[model samples]
Target: MKRKLSILLALVMILSLALPMMAGAETVSLAYKNGSLHLRKGPGTNYGSNGYVRDGDYITVLSKGSVWSKIETSAGRIGYIKNLYISGNGANYADGTSYFGGSYTGYVVTKYSGSSVNLRAGASTSTASMGQLRNGTKIKILGENGNWYLIETASGTQGYMSKTYIKSSAGSSSSSATQYATVTGSVVNVRAGAGTQYVVKTALTRGTTVKVLEKTTSNWWKIQWGSYTGYMSANYLRMK
Candidate 1:
């Protein structure tokens, strides 16, 4: 625990120091050919590769140099890439600004259920505030830069947020996350949506155990049965 705390503190301090240089950091896109461009811990191939950046991927150039450029990837990783691989071209948003794009899903995981996390214009804490997202809120993970994530809320609000406060799953794979229930009816139909109009995804036998993901409504609950995730009527499910 002490080691973890020390590491977290050290990382925060490092990011704090990097905030100024990243404040006005030039955002750019990668310009590599087929295959991925290696992101190294140092500026040269002599340095170890830490990650891969595809062609045209958005990156924030923290510090530019003649031969090498220190950058933060859209996935929140910091590394160095060759200067020749950096390009100024990218998709321009309606606001006339460049933003990263992604299709994965994630949820806000704050310290407390009532607490919220800040959204900013840039990855640094010193950036302009955009808004806040509350715990348990689902978001579209656009990309990550530094230790921050570029996310879009369900309401369409997009901005950068600390990556530490979000998770890829609805809950951790732990005993506490085991919200179990039993199929009450002899056989129950699990639909793709919350209503009968949706297609039946699968069928659950009587007394079959399932993991309840969310109680979408008093009548319908989203559940996980074996490998299937769909909605089942609450009337046919008895929470355990």
Candidate 2:
């Protein structure tokens, strides 16, 4: 009985130390407005998407994990989102910086030939496998969840790739040449600047391809669609 009591006390101590960081009533706002951050049903991208939360929408953080946070929206909805997609209070990343979006390009790599990496339909290793990607197969990393990356293949396949076997396509994928991407959301606004307070320049429909120029300090992609050059949220653009 004494031994069990000691163990219980130790567990309580651990919880006491850890709970403050995870549970709080502090208010925060969604950060990555590339368009809107997907509100998830659970802690990771393996969970179903509840919907989307736009940038600057204030939320009450119910709990926080290293990679995900549970929040209550101003509308009183509860959902999960990546920690980097939030800011204001109690928002932080493992690297000590708040960065959202997995907009870079990546590729599958392995030590041996013929060994393919599994791309899962969700973020977990236990999730259903969509397909396998061979070594050197290029992928567009759109977002992240724990140890997996939400990726889209050239043939329009979307899935999760383990970060262990995938690496960023570093050198040849540099920003020198012209880049292009398609808008994923329905009718995303091309703004004069990065935030919602900025004037809306125009609206780009889904499947419309635009020339990517650069990302603003606030993370909006400066794009050129037709003759109009303006900024759009990074969330809505699929970096192709």
Candidate 3:
């Protein structure tokens, strides 16, 4: 009897430590635009509604099937949510700053400092924005910079934002390479071809951070990421 009791206590201690790590491993966030999302008892809509979830709710995504994701709610409620309604905005990469393989139902201001904040593009000041920001505001970071960031707000406002006001408790992977640039205050045209006069794919916003693949000339650097690519103003990128 004594030996059994001792063994039981030992098992309990091991489980206590392991449980917390496992619980923290598979976490995800709800999208800011998501409202009245149904939580099912299992990883399928056919399973039946376990409860209703709102925006800004933090949940743990345990596993995923084709269209449904099994999530553990904050209240210890386990259920499923459809993938279509969830925004996997930061779900593509595992880089410690992004939430990959999961859904974000709402925007949670991860960081908050003073009442004012400076928004940037691609996570740095090299990116331009419409203007400054305030506190308690939720924004989505499209990309990351060296301590700065590029973020989009709820009302379809896309621009640059500082990292000081945003925080994320989700798991992140290792960081990637550095892509820095300068601001020439010019509307650098992003082209599909690598020349001065190609079909203008899109116009780069002022202070946008771009990854420099190769410097085609003293004035142009081949860059691409997330959809846009082509020749941008060399003066705008800080090539080392």
Candidate 4:
């Protein structure tokens, strides 16, 4: 009877220690004062835009890169958000685990005046205007173009607004290295070989960020990401 009791107590102690280890996993939240956010390809602003994320959204921090957090949206969309945008408001695990979040960091308009902006599909320029943006609204710019800018409105709408309407907001500057690289405006086919005649492996999702390893010519670039690497069209990749 004494041996059985000792065995039972030992098993209970082991389970207690194991339980906490399993419970250490957690989710994170996304919040900011400016109310606007950008989702990038790989956690830093250097990558191109995958989509726009708003304040109060919950994103799962899957992994951490130097200053960035690889997060997943409620819709299962995976992308990277700056550590400055995460609010780490939840309780920390007793196992010495913690996370991070950020206050609102502002963005700036990157172009001068008189730049033409194209309204994207599903965006209405008439009723869904870019927050009273006229030819010049002195707005906060999120991205740049040779002729336009991606801007955020006071009301949280993100669209291509003419750069001619806005100037750099106060305190909205970054290092030259932090400046965004232009992603190709067109979708390119992901192929199995380095030539156009190669077999089609798959169609890369629009807004996917790819690393250009080598430029075969003006039209093709050797690219790689994750476990897949091959030649893709230069017309599809933006310079970063």
Candidate 5:
């Protein structure tokens, strides 16, 4: 009995020492736009897309190649993405930034700061907000007008961001682009506008999937739930 106990303790000690190393694997976040970066079975695009990671999702980098990189998603599914789409050590890469639907011209990297930067329909703050770009989000500069930079997001969201909140960066990537949000509050009230002062249009239960139309600079999401359109507090939302 004593011998058996000693052997078990030795095994436990070995496992305890090995556990940290196993969990310490290098990890990186996928910076590509929504539905664009495919986690493939092989290092190239020809391989089957076994899974996918969107902007702001973190995964483990197993190995890397010149054009492709092997990665394991947080879900433990192994795959590969174009080497350009993954960022490490909180760093951003310029070559991997993707653009869409505009005059095919040269691209420049711009940095955004603050909790969120409003992408507006025009160059002024009074213009309608098309969406909100998260902090560290990179904008591919298409053109510039005065203090505003005409930019495009990975999801093809094109708008102008103020020059005040933007800095010319070496490079950056889309961090946590809004795709969908799951309601976390138990029967949270849905406001008609982006604030509490607005009327309660309806209520959404926990686990309800909300169609994220766009985000306001105030951190409210204009969402569509069951044919009712309104804004909700972004604080109670979770992304899958």
Candidate 6:
């Protein structure tokens, strides 16, 4: 009876440790690619190609070895790809460890002004419009399909938006970034319009402080730089 009790206790301890390890497995995805990327059945090129992932193909990263990672596609296909090709919100780790830093995420910014991008039920423009994302509304990207990205607004609205009208950033910015910013880049150009097609007014050297006048609907900051008010790409400005 004593031996049986000891065996049972040992089994419970092993199960307890393994349970959390199994629970920690998480989802990750292949980063954006212009062309098709292949997923092999095993971790190396010697393995057979099992499937392919496109521009916004999201997958679950199962495990990471030294050079390759095992992943599962949305369609349930399992395969491996080079670790360098994988990108995701690092919130969860494949080895059942949690990332101490913030989880990986992406941002969505409007491309142009005067119009809102339709959030649809499907990737195509013809799909049902679930809602609209206004200019400069930052959203957390969840996944992608073709030229469309799956995103969720801060208000918890989720849908698809065309990639053409919205730009994707690697992570979120400080809440005050839209209100005030500092120039981080050397000689950043101040443009007449929100986009590069606009005329260049002048250039601001690094460390210049600018008042946050307005964030144009197209991701440009309309700023006041010592009375020379013009537009600059939001990318170069860091929130004060």
Q: Where does the lowest 10-residue lDDT sum fall in candidate 4?
A: 94-103
Could you give candidate 5's per-residue lDDT for residues 84-188 as a string of tens digits? Answer: 555555443212332221222222333533567777755668655766877766556544445565677777755667756654442222222334678888888
The better-scoring model by lDDT among 3 and 4 is 3
Reference-based TM-score, model 1: 0.32
Q: What is the TM-score of each candidate against the true structure?
A: 0.32, 0.38, 0.26, 0.27, 0.36, 0.33
lDDT of 5 at 132: 82
Could you give candidate 2's per-residue lDDT for residues 94-157 as a string of tens digits? 1211122336777788789878988774566764566799988988766555566667789876
Off by over 4 Å in 5: 1-25, 31-36, 54-58, 73-76, 90-218, 221-240
| Model 3 error, position 192 (Å) | 40
- Residue 152, candidate 6: how far off, in angstroms? 11
Candidate with the greatest lDDT versus the true structure: 2
After superposition, candidate 4 runs with Cα above 4 Å error? 1-34, 90-240
lDDT of 3 by residue, 109-228 (tens): 434455566653234444333456676565555443345443557765544355455554232311223344543456767777666767888777766666655444234556775586
Residue 46 deviation, candidate 6, in Å? 32
lDDT per residue for candidate 1 within 61-142, as digits (tens), equals 7888877888888678899986655555432211222222114567888888888888775566865565687888888765
Task: Compose the digit string of candidate 4's lDDT tens values, residues 1-240.
Answer: 999999999999999976643443333322212245678987566888888776556666778776788877766678887664555554211111110111122343335554444432111233123224433334434443333444455666545444333444334332122321223545567787767889977667656776555444234556776677776765556554
Error of 4 at 232 (Å): 58
Better structure of 2 and 5 per TM-score: 2
What RMSD value applies to candidate 5? 13.1
Q: How accurate is candidate 4 locally (lDDT)?
A: 0.50
Model 2: residues >4 Å from true position, as ranges? 1-91, 94-104, 107-171
Off by over 4 Å in 3: 1-34, 84-240
Off by over 4 Å in 1: 1-101, 170-240
User: What are the lDDT scores of the predictions, listed in order?
Assistant: 0.68, 0.69, 0.53, 0.50, 0.63, 0.62
